[model samples]
Target: MELFAVEIRTPQWQPMILWYTSALNMKAAVRSVEDGYALLAGRGWRLSLLELQEDEPRDRSAISLALEVENLSAVRERIESLLMEPSAPIETSDEGFLQWTTTDPDGNRIKLFQFVAVD
Candidate 1:
């Protein structure tokens, strides 16, 4: 089965929205400030952002999302330009992928990778 969307709850909705839009270079397909939600689309992924309630528990360090990208380096550069530091150095796996991890403003982990065929 194919994946459709991922729901991310955060207290910082505006910055989260801005971050996703800028990093992915895509606009929200759906958004409702009143409802406190937004849906953002990239090449083959959809991110749903939900406003965190005051009573809800937030453990941003525990959230992690893996994304397959076309150009890992470019994505890394874009992220750095946005002033977000990657958590680790980019590395290639024996399985033929270049990867790196980074965190959002609220400390949500984002792992990005690109497949690279090894000769």
Candidate 2:
């Protein structure tokens, strides 16, 4: 089965939308402020954010999303330019994957990785 989208609930919708758009360099494929929902599409993946009520607890630590990119350096530069710090230093895994982790405004862990062929 093909995965179409992943949905997240956040107390802050507008800022979350802006964060995803800027971080991923993607635009919302579907957005409805009145309905409290936004769907962001990038690199064939869909990220949907739904508005959460004030009473709802927001704990994003349990949700970690990993994205594979072609240019790890470029993505790192973009993240640095945004003035946000990564959760840890970037390192190459034993499996030859260059990876790092960062959190969004709501504290959702985002893992960025790229496959590096070792000569």
Candidate 3:
């Protein structure tokens, strides 16, 4: 047997969303989030915007998903590249996982986590 290839495959949730309050406000949420998507797209990140139910008490809070390319730097760059610069700068988790949180046009928190590369 021989090695074929390895690459960041699927996304794994390294850390859960730590916020207690749900950032709501749809119209404004999309408006701001759209800016995020446009910036990511510009960076060659194919963004998949999804409406999904969050976990626990925050379940009621709306969420905007960003499924981008599986490169840590790429993921971080696309997010940081945003003109708005997010509420906070991109950060790496204790586990060396890169993470970033932004708000949509409304106020819904949009979290971006990169996938691990593996074959």
Candidate 4:
């Protein structure tokens, strides 16, 4: 079975929405500001964002998402343009993928990668 969606709960509702849309280029498929929820679609996966109360217990650091991209550099530039620093610089994996690791507004890890072209 294929994975469809991942849900993230955060107190930074609008900031998280802006981060996913601008940084990852994900489209806001469903938005319910009144309900404090939003669904972001990227490629074939969907990300669900839900608002959380300040005193709510949330392990934002426990969530991670990896996205396969066609142009790692372009995505990097977009992320940088938004003044968001990556967790680390882009590097190539022994598995033959160029990967960039970064965190969302709420500190969720996001990995962006592209298959390395071998000549």
User: Any runs in candidate 1 off by more than 4 Å, and if so which?
Assistant: 1-60, 84-87
Query: With candidate 2 superimposed using the best TM-score fit, by how many Å does residue 55's alpha carbon deviate from the native?
Result: 1.6
Candidate 1 residue-wise lDDT, 29-109, digit = tens: 999999899989998788878888778787666555667788888888878876544347899898798988788887776
lDDT score, residue 117, model 2? 88
Q: How accurate is candidate 2 locally (lDDT)?
A: 0.77
Q: What is the lDDT of candidate 1?
A: 0.79
Candidate 1 has what TM-score?
0.47
Q: Which has the greatest lDDT? A: 4
- lDDT per residue (tens digit) for residues 5-116 in model 4: 5767789999999999999999999999998989899997899888988998866566666677888899888887655553478998775889887778887767788888
Residue 98's lDDT in candidate 1:
90
* Pairs of residues at least 3 apart in sequence or in different chains that clash in candidate 1: none
What is each predicted model's overall lDDT from 0 to 1?
0.79, 0.77, 0.37, 0.80
- lDDT for predicted candidate 4 compared with the true structure: 0.80
> Number of backbone collisions per candidate, in order?
0, 0, 11, 0
Model 1 Cα shift for residue 84 (angstroms): 4.8
Give the lDDT of residue 53 in candidate 2: 82
Question: How do the predictions measure up, each by TM-score?
Answer: 0.47, 0.47, 0.33, 0.48
